[model samples]
Target: MDSSAGHTPEPGSPDEPVVVLGVVAAPGQAIGLARKLVEADLTDHIQTTFPGARWQLELLEAGVVQPPAGDAEIVDATRDLLLEHEWDLVLCLTDLPLHVGKRPVVAHANAVHGVAVLSVPALGATGVRQRARGIITGLVGQLLGADADDLREHQKSPARSALRHRVRQLGTDVDEAGTAFTARVLTGNLRLLTGMVRANRPWRLALGLSRALTGAIAAGVFALVTADIWLLADTFGGIRLTGVALGSIIAITATLIIGADLWERGSSRQTREQVALFNIVTVITVVLGVAAFYAALFVLSAIGALCLVVPQVFGATLDHPAGFTDYLEVAWLTCSLATVGGALGAGLETDEAVRDAAYTQHPAEPI
Candidate 1:
C-alpha cells in the first residue's frame, strides 16, 4: 500500500543518481511531501531531459522528529560516497517551521546546492486541494497534452502522475474515487489531448448563453400575459391589475438564493464580508435588469391608453393602462422569476457551471 519504496532506482542507479532526500516533518502531509520532490515536472527546480541532458533520480526519506543524524556528520559520511556516486544535486524536504529559520541544516543545503534551498510548505487540507488541482491541470496542459478523451491515457502515464500524491490528499473516500478512476480510464478514448483546453472554457459565455435562452422564454410568457389580458379587458370588463403573487415570489426567490449561497459557502466560511459583497453585486444586477424592463413596459402601458374598455361596469378611467403600479409589479415579478430561473439553471447543470467557476483561471502556478 505504501507505494513509497517503489520509487527505488530502476535497473538501479548503476553509475550515479540525482539524489533527493525528503523529510516529512509534519504528520499528515507526507504524501505531498514525497511527490513534490520526485515529480520535478510537477513542482520545482529540476531540468527536464533535453538534448545532452540526462535525468536519473535518487530519493531518500527521513523524519522531522528524528532527522538522519547530525547534518555535519551525515554530510561528512556521505561526502566521499556522493563524490564517488557523483550526485548532481542534493534536495532536502521538510515541513518543520524551524527548518526555515536561520538554522544550520538549511545553511548546509545552501552550501551544497549553491543557492538557497527549494522548499514547499506543509500542504494543509485547503493547500492540498489547490495544489492537487494545479498539478492535474498543469500536467493536462503540459505533457501528454490531451483533449478530454485522452485523460485516462495521460493518467496512466508519468505525465498524469506529476501530482498524484497531492491529489491523494483530497480526502475523497477511496470508494467514491472508484468512479473518478474509471472515468479517467475511459477518458483516453474521447476528447483527445487537445480537447481539454477547448472543453474547459470559462463561465461567462456558458452562463450568458443559458441566461439568454431563459430570458427569451420569460419574455414569451410576459408577452402572452399582455396580449391575453389586454384583449380580455377590452372585450369584458377591464380592471386595474395588481400582481398578487409578487411578494410571495420575491420571498421564495430570496430564500432560495440565500440558502444556496449559504450551502455553497459552507460552515467553514465565517467571514460575512465576501457574502455581503456577492449579495450586493447580485442585487445590483437584478435591480438594473428590472428597472430597464419595467420602464419600457410602463411606456408601452401609457401607449395602451388609446384603447377602449369593454364590459364597462368597472368604470376606471386611466391616464395609462400601464401605471406606476404596473411598473412596480412587473419589476418585482421580473426579478423573482430571474432569480429563480438562474438558481435552477445553476443547480441543474452544476457539473458544467461548477467546473467553469472553479477553473476559470486556467492552470494555477505549480507548487
Candidate 2:
C-alpha cells in the first residue's frame, strides 16, 4: 500500500530539522485516538520536552492488517511502517489487548528502531484520549532521544502521575527489541476487561438487532393490552418481578451467545486463557446490550400502558386503586416478556451479523 494514499500529512517546514512521526493505528477506537493525536498537535508538546526539531505526524489507518500478537511481531510491523514511510519514528496503536507473559502490556518502545507499539485497551475505559496523548508524548519523547528522567521532569503535572503510575517499564537488556511497559497486575486486568468492553461498544449491538427490536416491541405492545398481564403485574411482588427481569435478561444474553456461537474455544493452555478472556468480554458486551434493549422496552411499555390502559378500568380489574407503581409494574413485566421475544427474534439474525455487531474487530483466532 502507498504510504500517503489517503490521509493528509500534517504541515511542517522542509527547511527546518523536522522529525516525521508515522502513526499506524488499527481501525475503530485506535484510529480515532490517532486522529486526536494529530489534532492535539503532540509535536508542539514534544518540543517542550525534547526541544530543537520541528515534528510532523503522518497517520495510516490499518484496518485490513491483523493485529500483531506479540512484542516481536509488533516491532516488525512498526519497522515495516517505517520502511514504507519517510518517518523518523513510528508508533503503532491497536485496540487489541496485548499480553507479555501473564501481564497485560500497555506499550513497548524500541529506541534502536525508533518505534513503539501501544495497546489502547490497556489504558482502560475512562479518560482514554488524555491517557493516550500523555503516553504517546512520553513514548515519542523517548524515541526523540529524551531520557526517562528528562521526559518525566518536563511532562506537565497532570500527566506526570499517569506516566509514573500507569506505565512501568521493564526489560533492562539494551537490544534492538527494546523495553516493555506493562500495567500493574490486579488493576491492570480490571482495566483490560473494561477497556475491551468499551472497544466492543455494546450499545451498537442493540442498534444492529433490528429484527429483535421489532419482535420485542410487538411483544411489549401486546402485553400492554392484555388484562391478564395487567392483573399479574399488579399482584406480583417486587422480588418476584426482579427475579423475572433477571431471568429474562440472562435468557436473552445466553441465547445470543449460543445462537451466534460467540463463545471462544481454544486448544493450547495459553490459547485457553486468552479464550476465557475473550469469552468474558463477549458475555459482558451481550449482557449490556440486552440490558439497554430492556430499558428501552420498559420505557415504551410504561408509556403505552399509561396512555392505553384507563386508570379506573385497571383499578376495577385489579380490585384496587391504580397508582404510579402500577404503571411501573406493567412496564417491568412487559420488559421481561419483551426480552424473551427479542431472544426468539435474535434467531433470525445471521451469525456473521451478530459477530460483526458484537466485536470491535475480528480476532485472527477462530471464535
Candidate 3:
C-alpha cells in the first residue's frame, strides 16, 4: 500500500494559486492525527487563517521512520521529504517527545526551508486533536511567512487567537530550526509524561500480559474456594487490605520493569534526561496496566465469592455472620494475592515480549 496515499491535489495550471502542504507523520498516534487532519478538511481552516493561497493538504506515513535524537535531525528529515515531494511546505508529526535544552518542544518551524516538526506528545493527553490542529495551523502560518502585522490581524479572530495561545514561542539558540514553541515549564513536563503514556496505550498492556493474566485468574479462583483465605480476609482490617493491594501493585510493576529490563540507563546529561523520561513513562504504563489487571481480578473474584462461597460456611469460617462487605473483603484480599502470583508469572514472559507490551516503538528507540 502507498503510505502517502490521501488527499491528492487537484490538477491545475502552473498559474494556479494552490499551495501543497505535505504532512509526514510517524506511525501510531501521529499518523492517526494526520488522518484526522485530512478528515477535518483543515484546508478551509488554513485558508481562513492565512487568507491568501488555497491550501492542498496531503498525508504521508513515516513507516518505520525512527525518531531522531535531536531537532536538527528532525528538520533534516523533513527537508529531505520536502525536496522529494511536490509540497510547498512539509509538517512532520512525531509521537516522540522532543526537547530544547530543558524545555519540552511543542513545535518547530524553519521558514527558510518551508518545513516544520510537531511533537505530538508535547501537546499533552487531553484535547489532543483540537490542540494539534491549532498548533499545525499556526505553524503553517509561520512557515508561509505571515508577518507580525498579519498575525495581529488574524489574532483578532477568536479561533486564530486561541490557536496562537496554545503554543508559546521559545528561543531558538539551541539549534537552527529558526522558531520553536514549548508548553509552560512545570505543567509541560506533566503533560508530556501523560502524553507519552497515552501514546503507549497502557490498556493494551493488560492484553499483552497473557501469561501473567492466566496465572492471576488461576490464583484468584483457587483463593476464592479456600476457607483459610476467607478467614484471613475477614481478619484483615481495611487499612491492612489497602496496604496489601498497594504492595502487590508495586511489586508487580517493579518486577515487570526489572525482569524485562525496561529501565533505560544513560551516561550524558541529555541522554540521562531522555533515559529518565523513558523510564518514567515505562513505569507509569506498567503501573496502569497492572492496576487494570488488579481491577479485573477484583471484579471476577467478587462475583466468584458471591456465587461460589456459601454464606453460612463463610460466616462459620470467620466466626461471624458474613455480609456483602465480607464478600467484598474476600475479593479484595484475593485480588492482592492473585496480583502477587501474577508478578511471579510475569517472570515466565520473555523480555522482548514484555518490552513490546510496555513501550511504544519509535524509529530510533523504544519509549
In model 2, the runs with Cα more than 4 Å from the true position are 1-188, 361-367
Compute the lDDT of residue 95 as modeled in candidate 2: 75
The per-prediction tally of clashing pairs is 12, 0, 3
lDDT of 1 at 139: 29
Alpha-carbon TM-score of each model against the true structure: 0.26, 0.52, 0.52
lDDT of 3 at 69: 55
Model 1 lowest lDDT segment of ten: 165-174
Looking at model 2, report the run of 10 residues with the lowest lDDT sum.
169-178
Q: Tens digits of per-residue lDDT for model 2 on 169-243?
A: 110111121122111222333544565576567887878888788888888888889999999988898999999
Candidate 1 clashes: the total is 12
Name the TM-score of candidate 3.
Answer: 0.52
32-52 per-residue lDDT for model 3 (tens digits): 888987888577777666543
Q: All candidates' lDDT scores?
A: 0.32, 0.66, 0.67
